[model samples]
Target: MKPQLLPRKSPRQARSKALVTAILDATAQVLVERGYAGSSTNLIASRAGVSIGSVYQYFPNKDSLIAALRERHATDLYDTLDAVLTRRNPQSLEEKLSAIVHGWMLAHQLEPDLHRVVEQEFPFFERAHQDQIPIYRTIVERVRQLLEEHREQLLPDNLDLATWMVLQTIESLIHAATTTTPLPVHQPAAIEQQIVEMLTRYLQVVNPR
Candidate 1:
């Protein structure tokens, strides 16, 4: 067999990626300190130590910067999630759900700033459908696959509905737990327990008592 060839990134593409990364790093720092309204191109340029002209060379406006940053934030989360999901062993459905939830919580705790900026500041760009829909759809599909694997245990007809319901519930709970303020003293344990309880109640097949 001929050697499989990996497509190589052009030098221009590589440089563009570097510039975009620098701009995004600068934007995140500014957003943390100054809030969305104050994150101007000049400030981002100054923080990145790049020329204002250079900043505009890649990102046409501040909105473009925010959009790129938001996409990067999502991409980072998805990448981390992919790693966790890959390592998970085939096991009880409850164990799988717990593993996924724990990984999500850990990721949120580690990158709360990026999470806040993405949640609060990023606008829905033209490419949002292209970018975001696939991520959600993939999550739904994974849940559906897991349910299929354990179909004998679950109500057969409601698999898709259950998958979507479980996904939405977990996502909403995580967002609330991570984003809520007046930070709770027992937040870490509280969130974990809440996730386990919610999922167990929804997924368990015990007949009504």
Candidate 2:
């Protein structure tokens, strides 16, 4: 078990809220324009037009700031997943999976470089904010149910392992697609189809076990 990196407190008032928003917005630009090494509190404050003290008021350190950014990203992705779950197509697992995949895809596309920086440059950030990762458990649970419901269409046993693979496959591929340099062509429709096709086929037992 690890402690979650977090801000000192959340913004409550309208003015303070605006300041936090500006700070985070500026943080994103700094992260994009400058790598993690260059994204210092002074630089972020200067970019945000707020005093460096204001930054410290909300975030204790650079790591905390980065963690908050990661938290924001996680929230967006989870919200997208929640929205997809609300109207998931019951008859078509592909449609349901596609919605989840595309929702997360859009979330990553919101800040690709920052996402890369969080994942590649400071992988520890993920560990620091491990608290937020469980939001994704809903996806895995839903997937497990899908596996059980379609047991005849899928393998008899190992539904748990299959579910993990399906979740990881979508997550890893999309993360690579968004973060890799000399990035692969991101034809949304084609990518979605390929993901759905691969996942569907993998779950489908051609030779029954």
Candidate 3:
């Protein structure tokens, strides 16, 4: 049987929301410091400064909290990228690529440790959120739409496949640069420039800059 990997209830009131946020924040810290094996509701509750009962009041167990944490992290990232991608300001494809790569890196930079842990355990969290729209799909669809806007300038005939390749390439490079140390491109500015240039070339931008 599948474990109950969801909150027992949603926190609606401001106070309840704050309490839940505290719990998830503690969960992230604990997961970062101790990893999934070492984490537990007891440790999370203590870290959150809440009673175990209070923890159980919302989350059924530690896994549920981790799931919630991952969900929140994914939502926050999607929102950040969505805002950047959906903005009305006109931009060349290269400019859009730069903004998106930087935005993704910036979001991960804010919580690098937690991002690493949650992403490593994504399969588990992925299962927990199976009923909902995947965040990655939403971001990809948005980027694909951006590509559709400039199809004439792009080389790939299939924008859908091209979008996937582009996003996966950007995500893999940025994820490695942020989560792993001693990368070839260690600085954020350098990484962003390299990625934008790389994707622009791969997409065969009509007029190379």
Candidate 4:
């Protein structure tokens, strides 16, 4: 149909903004209930109590609408990480790692249904969301910087590689634990502790030299 990328035009007024919000929320609901393919713009408009024209005003097709949902979720994750990174570190890096574990877990758990549906309906690890690479890379770089600051605590190797590895470890596990059927780890607290231990040992300052 149409190239489903950016919105046709951003909402400028309060009423239009609210309508867009409703449309997005409706789309999320539809995705959860009917999965990705069933989340059509017409169906979303109906659930949003709006006209098909209104949905088309913002999103050209289901692809654009789903992209919006994907961006929204990514924003939530970055915002959560920002909150932790902005705070003063009054605790050990291990404790901060634990906070991050908790933050990501809670963030995904915030929309478990949507998350599961997205995983099932979209090829997130593939080309569909390739446009989001820079967004993810920026976050990875932020984490890399954080790790570099604690270079003394990490193995004296390529810090960039180490940060990337750590990120993949955490992301892969979180994705599995949250979206997979019969989760890879069911005990939330235990899993959190395990991750903390894993990262803690991996990044500990062994030699000051």
Question: lDDT per residue, candidate 2, 55-152, as tens digits?
Answer: 99999877777877876777788787777667675466666667878787777787888888777776456543444556556556777887776676
TM per prediction: 0.76, 0.80, 0.84, 0.84
TM-score of 4: 0.84
Candidate closest to the true structure, highest lDDT: 3
> What's the CA RMSD of model 3 in angstroms?
3.3
Cα lDDT of model 1 by residue, 1-209, tens digit: 42211112212787777876787799888988887777798999999989998876767777767766655555655666667777876387777777777767766676577667667765544333432545545655777887787767665468878877777687667867787452475677677777877877777754432
lDDT of each prediction vs. the true structure?
Answer: 0.68, 0.76, 0.80, 0.75
* Candidate with more favorable, higher lDDT: 1 or 3: 3
Worst 10 residues of 4 by lDDT: 123-132
At residue 113, what lDDT does model 1 achieve? 71
Give candidate 4 regions above 4 Å deviation. Answer: 1-3, 84-90, 123-135, 182-186, 207-209
Question: Could you tell me which residue pairs clash in candidate 4?
Answer: none
The list of candidate 3 runs beyond 4 A from truth reads 82-90, 121-123, 126-136, 182-186, 207-209
- lDDT of prediction 2: 0.76
**How high is the lDDT of residue 47 in model 2?**
96
Residue 114 lDDT in candidate 3: 83
In candidate 3, residue 78 scores what lDDT? 84
